[model samples]
Target: MDFERTNPIERDAYKNFDDSSELQSDIRFDQVETRLLRQQQDDEYLQCLREDQEREQRKTQKLLDIEKLLANLCLDEEEHQKKKEEFVKMKEPMLLAIEEELSKLCLEKHERDRQKEQLDKMRKEKAPRIPVEPPAGLPELAHLAIRLPNGERIMRRFRHTDKLKDVFDFIFCYPNAPDWFDISVPLPRRDLHCEGSTVSLLEAGLVGKHALIPKRLRLTTDTTALTLRTTPSEEGLDNRRDAC
Candidate 1:
């Protein structure tokens, strides 16, 4: 009965409380807006740091790539040097065989010169024509075997080329020809590794020179075409020191 009688005063107090609460809520919204703005600015800084970290990783990866490339280049250089050394080693035996042959030829020429001198002096004296006799094989020359210098035979044999007459007259004819004749031969048509192979050229040129019997089945270059050349087989050439 009291609430009903004082209901208008109670309604007025309630309306005043509701208005104050709404005002307080508006103030709280303002404070939250300020805090959110600051947090967004902090997040921007974190994002920048993440980007920098990613960029550093990219730089590190690039440096590693460059290092790998450098390593590969070094490896290639080492391989090239190794190949050069191998080529020099392969050439040594062939050179020695050539030099030995040259020494033998020189001694023969010296003996020939001495013989000519004796003959000329005898002719100047007007002596009666004596029956010409073959000189006994100079014991020294007899010792010199064509198959091998040290009297050891090898598996392969080499002969001079017919077209090599000009080569002999031109290149090997030099004073060193008897000493350092490195005869280049032609490769066979069917031989593998003919390109830059000395043995191929030697086999072809020799077969063409009547040094070796030419057989359809034998390893031979096309003498007519005269293609590639390669180094001679090491052990074989070492045995045939006279082939040069």
Candidate 2:
């Protein structure tokens, strides 16, 4: 028929060839898609493995830090216990020494109390002796200069007939006299007792130029009361004493 017009067989062959080419192309496209999918899966698997490795490393580092903290806490607790033990050891001897000192003080106090009781008993048993009155012929007034232990002189004018208690009262009542003192004279060196002596100053030999040493006596008792008595020796009274 016509060269440009297709024959049925030729047309049919051409159609078959086109169909085969399309089929081959479709097969190749499918194979390329499958390969791309497999490669994507492999990349996903590699990323997951990298992430797991990082997580494992972080966990191991945290565990190491926790172990270090625990070790430090253990060391601090041990040091605190050691210091407490040392303090206890040092305190023991100090406590023992304080107890011993208190015991010694108690014993000494007991001894002092015993001695005080004996002196009190003796003072209570003995009756104070009555003192002699001033002699009948003595002058009415006597000018006396009494020197003290501190090198100070007390100038006084007194009645010869005045009681020895009056002279002592004047001395104790003096502004310069201490709260507690004992009166004595040198040469005879007699301690004047200040209790209940009714003797005159002239009879007690406290008149004229006499150095009446007022000795500062330590208080043996709690009482602030003063006790004085003149010596009973007539020769001691008769001696004229010089300035101290």
Candidate 3:
């Protein structure tokens, strides 16, 4: 007690000292603090792991979409190939068919042309021949008024007119028949005659057909023996030859 009185720090410490109170009160252990800090670090690590997992899922989805697109492209390419093959198959047959049709037409045309030529030759060979002169000379006065190629009126006369209609039945002769003309048919766009045009009888006998004149006829209408004739087309007038 005397020593405590002499030391002021010991007196204050003795005055607060309580023998009944406990020494440990609300104190945290170092091991427990270290464990809590470690738990906090683990929680941070789990959060980072979750974020990484979500990012990976998004990336995987993108890859799946790309794969699907690639698969569709492949399918489209296959379909295109199939369609192209089908088109070629269809086109080939059509082309062959068209070629066959063209060949058939060509062959048919050639055969028809050949037949036409043969028929034309037969008609020419079987056609009856005409004579350019009259038989006994009743009256020989024939004249031809022609519209020239230059659109001019040119007159020509043949001495005699022959009615060889008894020889050839198929003849288109109208008006005055010429001695050198037996058939006078107008060609299209050819104006060789007009209304009231006097075509000589002698020239009408020779018509469009080629004929050989047996002899020339003298005009007995006016006591004048002027050999005047009318012919529509004189294309075959020089075909006259002496008939024995």
Give the total clashing residue pairs for model 3: 30
- Give the per-residue lDDT digits (tens) of candidate 3, residues 169-198: 112121122232222223221222222124
Q: Report every candidate's CA lDDT.
A: 0.37, 0.54, 0.39
Give the C-alpha miss distance for residue 117 in model 2, angstroms.
Answer: 28
What TM-score do all the candidates reach, one by one?
A: 0.21, 0.36, 0.26
Alpha-carbon runs more than 4 Å astray in model 1: 1-19, 31-35, 73-244
Cα lDDT tens digits, model 2, 69-182, are: 445443466876775566567568857977998998898677656644543443333323222334444666555544543445586766667766665555554544542456
lDDT of 1 by residue, 174-244 (tens): 22222122232112223223233333324343332111111111123342222122221111111111221
In candidate 2, stretches whose alpha carbon ends up further than 4 angstroms from where it belongs are: 1-140, 222-244
Give the CA lDDT, 0 to 100, for residue 186 in model 1.
Answer: 17
Deviation of model 3 at 116, angstroms: 3.3
- Candidates 2 and 3 compared by lDDT, better number: 2
* Top-TM-score structure, candidate number: 2
Output the number of the lDDT-best candidate. Answer: 2
Ordered list by lDDT, greatest first: 2, 3, 1
